[model samples]
Target chain A: SQQGEEDPQALSIQEGENATMNCSYKTSINNLQWYRQNSGRGLVHLILIRSNEREKHSGRLRVTLDTSKKSSSLLITASRAADTASYFCATGVANSGGYQKVTFGTGTKLQVIP
Target chain B: EAGVAQSPRYKIIEKRQSVAFWCNPISGHATLYWYQQILGQGPKLLIQFQNNGVVDDSQLPKDRFSAERLKGVDSTLKIQPAKLEDSAVYLCASSPPVNSPNEKLFFGSGTQLSVL
Candidate 1:
């Protein structure tokens, strides 16, 4: 079963505008990571925020996690045409025996127009 | 430092035919995963391996699908008597040891399979 669900299945914005995507999960998670994928290409790791952390930043990307609500959001400041891609959120759950498995969200399709 | 590697970027096969995909994880990485991604959907974990041992395969369709990581470095996924609905992108990924909290996953370009 999938643990995360991303809102705004599709979004279109002009370059230089900010893009925001939200994800909600059903179970307790150890961490949540975001990834981007270009058309017909492999996924690239973007950012990861642990459950203990509330906010994290890397370059133009910012991620926030709210454990109380079981939701996370990713914000891209000053988006560019090159940022057009699909974004997905993956949740890592700590299981018995110290093993962890990641569950991915459906993803949001972001289209940045130049 | 080579990334994960997969072969035959694309494939087409008729229903009930068999197909196999291979993956080679990064050196010294102890975990490997196989995921299935349908059109306009997130990748679903089919199986996970810790070195050469199976860690999780509860979602794998055991009757028709099987995988093995013989040397703990390279792995293969095989689908016998494939179905039309089995058409999707087969993605291979790997991560470091379990203790690392900053572990980042590396993914391959994936093999797009079309079963007619």
Candidate 2:
């Protein structure tokens, strides 16, 4: 079963506008990571926010995690057409064996109009 | 470093037929994962391997699916008597270590399978 659910199943925005996607999960997590997938391609790791961290930034992407709410949000500033893709949030659960069990949420599809 | 590599970019087979997909992880990576992604849905973990040892297979359909990592470098996932529902993209990913959420996973292009 999937542990996380993303809001706004689909979004369309014009270039240079910001895009935001939200995700909520059900269990405690070691960390939450966001990934992007282009059409017919595998996923690419975007950014990871640890349970203790509230926010992180990389390039034009910013991610905020609220463990208390079991939710996370990814924001893309000044979105470009190249940013058009599916974004997914995956929750990493630390198992007793010490490995992280990663579960992905239903993704939000973002389309940037040029 | 090179990313994970998957073979047979596309495969087409008839129902009840057998098919196989191969994956080669990055050098020195100890963790490997295989995920099944149906159209319009997030990928689901099918199996995970740590240095040739099975770490997790709970989500794998043992009746028709089997996987093995040979020599802790390359792996193969085989589906026997495939079903129409088995049609999906198979993705391969590898991480340098386990037990760390900070470790980033590198993914392959994946194999698109179509079961008629």
- lDDT score for residue A78 of model 1: 100
Q: What lDDT tens digits, residue by residue, belong to model 1 across residues A5-87?
A: 99999999999999999999998988899999998568999998989999999999999999999999999999999999999
Candidate 1 C-alpha lDDT tens digits along B1-116: 89999987999999999999999998988889999999999999999998899989999999999999998999999999899999999999998754485577889999999999
Question: Across residues B53-108, which tens digit of lDDT does each residue of candidate 2 receive?
Answer: 99899999999999999999999999998999999999999886544544877899
Residue-wise C-alpha lDDT for candidate 2, range A22-95, written one tens digit per residue: 99999899889899999957999999888999999999999999999999999999999999999999998766
Off by over 4 Å in 2: A96-98, B98-102
TM-score, candidate number 1:
0.97
Report the first chain's TM-score for all candidates. 0.95, 0.97
